[model samples]
Target: MDAPISWAEARTAMHEAGRQGARPAVAVPLSETDGTTLAAPLTSRTDVPAFPASAVDGWAVRGPQPWIPEGRVLAGERPPALTRPGTCMEIATGAMVPEGTEAIVRLECAHHEHGRITGVARARRDWREAGEEVSAGEELLPAGSPVTPAVIGLAASSGHDTLHVHRPPSAAVLVFGDELKTAGLPGLGRIRDSLGPSVPSWLRRLGALPVEGPAHPVADTLEDHLAALTSALKTADIVCTTGGTMHGPADHLHPALRELGAEYLVDTVAVRPGSPMLAARLPGGKFVCGLPGNPQAALTALMTLTEPLIAGLTRRPLPSLRTVPVAEETIGRGDFTHLAAARLDTHGRAHTLGHAASSMLRGVAAGDGFVVVSPGGVVDAGMHVPFLPLPLYAGEAPVAVRQEGVPAVPLPDQAHAHSTAPR
Candidate 1:
């Protein structure tokens, strides 16, 4: 068997593959730009607050206090200029401030009687100046920035009807294994298929647009694998296949890749539980990520390989790891790097969770992300370790962390003591 590459090397290799195969940018309406990556700098087409406007409901006064009343200026209307030195006009909030206005006297402070106005003007200017928030043609956000709700709002405010952004790469999941069942309880030498139903959700959170429909299942034969992969690659920029990564009799992933003339970018990674994960690029430039059959291991592969690949595909920089203190002593996997499922407390400490076996999903379901334990290293309590946060699923709330006064749980054993070869 070939030696496995380090986890970091595997991630880097897949990232480069994505960058080489990045999708072209397209102009999309501003209403549909959320979750896309910017292809060009988002520049303001017009000044924010295009005209000088009132910051409060007050009197637009010229030449100071005790001014004569003129007229009322409501929001959305262009008011006439305050030509006379002692004249004032009642102005509502957000109404354009007329030219020649010196200051604003708040409504409460002004007394109007006998068709005249008298009041003390506020110390601070009560009107917003044109282009005060943002000047026309200024870059609001740079290329590669993720289009968020705030970004969309800012784009609209700056007069952008549409934005040029990189279209999200589409992915397809191919589940392999003759012994896997799509539904019902696992029994009679057949287990329920987990990856088929879950992998698409993970891909979506990673910013990849998963092809519509449930994951396609492939039989454990070289011909079947080739057929399934060929079909998936036709529609998806990336194809994720679960199981069949090993060189066993039933494992056809490698043979299919060979027959398809795919180049191996990461044959395997040196990470516990997910060590057999592999990434390859087909001749057509689409990617293939081979995940282990184990549920937790498959998720780990998604983070280690698929996440960075999507980042590159969208022209985004590799996601940076956050450092947090360990809440308890944590063991490592000797030579292999360990990605321990963990929940982060409000205090910013990582509490490694239990039930983290390769096939178990309980730990990950309750955790915020994974805490990285470097090869051959043990992290003591209070020591800082790198954290890889899980992307938030659509409409999913953040995992609640332990609050003050909550008793800390003991650190559990590492997910697995030995590396799990691909099934």
Candidate 2:
């Protein structure tokens, strides 16, 4: 067999040729559309604020202090014109300004005695101007921008109750292993199904829909694997299979994919702990990613293949890689890239984690990001290296799991983890 390609080469090839996010845009309600990518440009249908409104609880004066008080204009009310510079109007927060008002006299500075306002500090408008936030026909955000809470607020302010956004991609995960148990601790040669519960969470963070039930754990038989693949393809845009990229008798990904008309885009990559991974494009513009059974190896494959795949499928931009200085020197492989779990310090420096074996996630769940060491690279202290980050909501602490069938693990808070790749 030909040697596996480099990690960078695999990423470039997949991105350059993967199906462009040509999925039709959907007009989703702003209430339920957080984290979606905007498919169409977000233009303001109406000017934000619509009309000039008071920014503070103050008096709307024509020009200066000691002006004649016109009347009270609370929020949601429009005041008539203050035709002369010597006149003033009592204006509340968010109230519309009179046409001829020159400035606002704040309640603190205005001396209100017998309904006559005075002591206007200066001649300045303290109200928001019409189209101050965004003007009508102005583009608030371009297509391909991720819809965040602030984005939704901006859309609402621009008179959009619904937004034209790229729909979230749906994915299916197939967990392949005979020795994997559905629950409980690993003992007596049977390990708990780690990927079944974890992969879906990872997928959701990448802007895919949440996996409803548990991940499908398939039997070792090839027929069973074929059935699972066929079923997942019918509903999912991408199917991720774990533990079958190798040539073991139980491994069935390569053979099943061939039978199912999948052409390999990435057979494997020259990366430590995840070199057995594979990726292919299936019929109907769908995709399949094969990950190793080891917990950390599966994570590596998720970042290496699944991350960019989801970005492309959902029409979001690929995450840009960042370089950071390491706290200590670490040895790296001579022939391939090595992704090691590491924790970031207060100053944004990286400290290597020791528990990054192929089978364990102790270091992964405890750390902030991975340090990508290049081929023949000697990582010295203060040397810069590429880093891939996980969504860090509250920074990964263990949670208690009481159910016998449930896996006890620490997961990031997906809602608060809105930013991608910590700087």
Candidate 3:
């Protein structure tokens, strides 16, 4: 068997695979492109502000102060040139300034006497020059950028009615454990199927459109596994299978992959709780990700492999890991990397959570994400460590508030709160 690869190596290999098989781009209207990835650079069709406009509700003075007041100009109206010397036009905010205009005198600062205006212009120009915000044909955003609400607004302001974006990849889940029950409570040594119901939600958060309907359990037999995989691959760009990742007696995932002529991109990762995870590229560029049966371990595998793959398929840049201080000492897994579930406090310190067993979900359920401890490395309190943020649903704010020049920490009100989910 091949040796387990590093967590970073696995992510990079899967991401490369997705990029090699990236989906084609399509032109979509701005209203329907919230979650898509831009396929082309977003360029400005015209200069931002388009023309010189007043930045304040004041007068557009031509040459000197003590100018005679002319007719008023509101926003969107064109005023005649200030050809007459010592003349000014009353201009509203965002109104285009006429030719030969020198400066703007704020309405409050202007002194009116004998129907003439007199005011000292501020040192800074009060009118926005043409192309002040963006020049014509300038690239606002590069290709592969995620289409966010702010991106949509920018596209609209840049004169784009429709944007060219890559379509979101689709995924399907297949639960492959006979001991897992699909409905009702666990009994008679049979456990309720958790991955079947939850994996799709995580996939959606990762920007993949999950196939419709609940995933049905696949029998432990090799025939059943092959059949389910074949059916799922027909529709989904990626198929995630739960359980049977290890080479145990009941594990048919490897055999099925071999039979399907799939090439292993990442056989396993040297990460605690998810070392049995695997990712492969099947014939024709479709992908299969094998996840351990343990709930938390499965999530770790999802983050380790599937997240980066989805990012590449959607043409988004790989998710960047941020550094956070650990509130307490964290033990590593000897030679293996440790992914410890942790929550962020208001001060941006990472507090490792208890009940973090591989089979348990409670630890991750209450935490923001995981803190990555390098192999054989013990992280002391106050030391900065790498952090992987949990996948978030569309429009949901991240658990950590990241402001420029500010520490990446949770807000006071959200210190102990989990990420908000849609009702």
- Name the candidate that leads on lDDT: 3
Clashing pairs in 3: none
Q: Please give the TM-score that candidate 1 achieves against the real structure.
A: 0.89
Name every residue pair that clashes in candidate 2: none
Compose the digit string of candidate 3's lDDT tens values, residues 282-338: 879999999999999999999889988988897776666666788999988876778
Summarize candidate 2's per-residue lDDT along 194-227 as a digit string, tens digits: 8988888888776677545334479999999899
> What digit string (tens of lDDT, one per residue) describes model 1 on residues 171-286?
99999999999988999999999889989999988888899533446878899898888888889999999999889999999999999998888888888879888899888788
* lDDT by candidate, in order shown: 0.83, 0.77, 0.84
Report the number of backbone clashes for model 1. Answer: 0
Model 3 Cα RMSD, 1 decimal? 6.9
**Candidate 3 TM-score versus the reference:** 0.83
Candidate scoring better on lDDT of 1 and 2: 1
- State each model's C-alpha RMSD to the native: 6.3, 8.4, 6.9
* Alpha carbon deviation, residue 180, candidate 2 (Å): 0.9
lDDT of 1 at 134: 96
Ranking by TM-score: 1, 2, 3
Candidate 3 deviant stretches above 4 angstroms: 63-69, 105-124, 181-184, 213-215, 393-423
